[model samples]
Target: MPYRHLFKALQWGLILFCLCFAMVGGTMAERLLELLQCQPHANPALRSCAWLPNALGLRLAPFLSAGGISDYPFVLLQNFWALIAVWMVALIATHRAARNAASTAALPDRGKTRYPGITGADAGRWASRAAFWVLLLGLAGFCMAFGTPILGNRVALEVLGALGCSPGTFDPFSSPCMSAPGFWTHRLAVYVIPLAGPLLAPVWLFMAFWDILLAWTLLTAAAYILQDHLSKRARRPAP
Candidate 1:
């Protein structure tokens, strides 16, 4: 039973890890392009900006509603989906663990318990920790990629310069204009101000940074929440 539960937990960990890297991988390229001020893929519909409210129940959007500590848009939906993926993985893992426990308990002798055919848990576990570590490394890679001057592309800054992009060209989570997030320099008490100041955009990349941070923060937080929820579920009395 211990082994089975551990396997199930690790399974969920693997799935969540995969999801973490997937978000960083899928959104990096295009969002980076937008951050670099490159014209999008021909009228895609994104319009180079997106939005969502902050934790304070205040509405916010890229380049529109600004000056709040958490105000920004969710420029990338793929990251949002990755967060959802984590929840699904956890649900499956817990259910499987529960089922396994029930089945094992039902047997008279229970000499050696084994699931004949795993409905969804058929996917056996081998080395989940190794995979999880790899995913963390990949996320670091994407975070680096999100930075200005794409690795090995010595001319990246020059290219941005030639294209008239901001000198502050940064990653999806950073302001392309190098502008600081509203809360960074403010005191804890001052950060509560809504529409505290005017938002100016010499370039669109500035807005992109806001959107990226907003989405990634929400997604990562959701991932954390799912992990906690699943961990608690596995401890509950079986129904």
Candidate 2:
């Protein structure tokens, strides 16, 4: 394929990312297991598990502190990997489209050529649609993050109530609802306040904008590659 080098690069990048993710996850898991092994009546010094931190490296102390691993780093890493995966898929689709266009161009009668794979126009259109939806979702999240506070806690409480969580018993800092079995409710409880509050709102907004920009960039690149491939194919004489 014309994008063979680019595809290999992406594969190596993904491998590196996975290795890093595994290291982080394994270290965190080991630390958690050590804490769980400590007896309730054990001495404070013995239960402290100082050696675990040392083994994991001093630089990770902040993340390993407070009896748990930080979720932010893991979330960021997962999202980054997801973005890379999407980009790789887009590149593969673009390459396939280019190949199909070339094959189509080889026929003496272009009108009679039956394209067996995705066409350049189709790939570009799908990429554009994906970009639009990503932007729309990002904007919606941005609005929700900023508007939740203005909407007040009543709306939040109502939603929580519908989820079988008691509004009167709900405590944002130490709520069991935050770690509920259901994914949507758990995420709602854990992130709604942080996203709406002054402390993390700016950070969330920045990440949201970053996501939008990445999606747009990916879409633009795919479109450009497809157009270039189609144009080159058009200029080639039929065999």
Winning candidate number (TM-score): 2
Off by over 4 Å in 1: 1-139, 148-208
Q: TM-scores of the models, in the given order?
A: 0.26, 0.29
lDDT scores in order: 0.37, 0.49
Top of the candidates by lDDT: 2
List residue ranges in candidate 2 displaced over 4 A: 24-130, 136-239
For model 1, the run of ten residues with the poorest summed lDDT:
51-60
The sequence of per-residue lDDT tens digits that candidate 1 reaches over residues 1-239 is: 56467667667776655543344433433344445553422111223322111110111012232322232124223224444565576566667767777776776654444434333322312123334444555545444433323231322332232222223223322323223233221111111112221111112223334565466556555555555555465457769
Name the 10 consecutive residues with the lowest summed lDDT in model 2. Answer: 38-47
Q: Give the TM-score of candidate 1.
A: 0.26
Against the correct fold, how does model 2 do in TM-score? 0.29
Candidate 2 lDDT score at position 215: 63
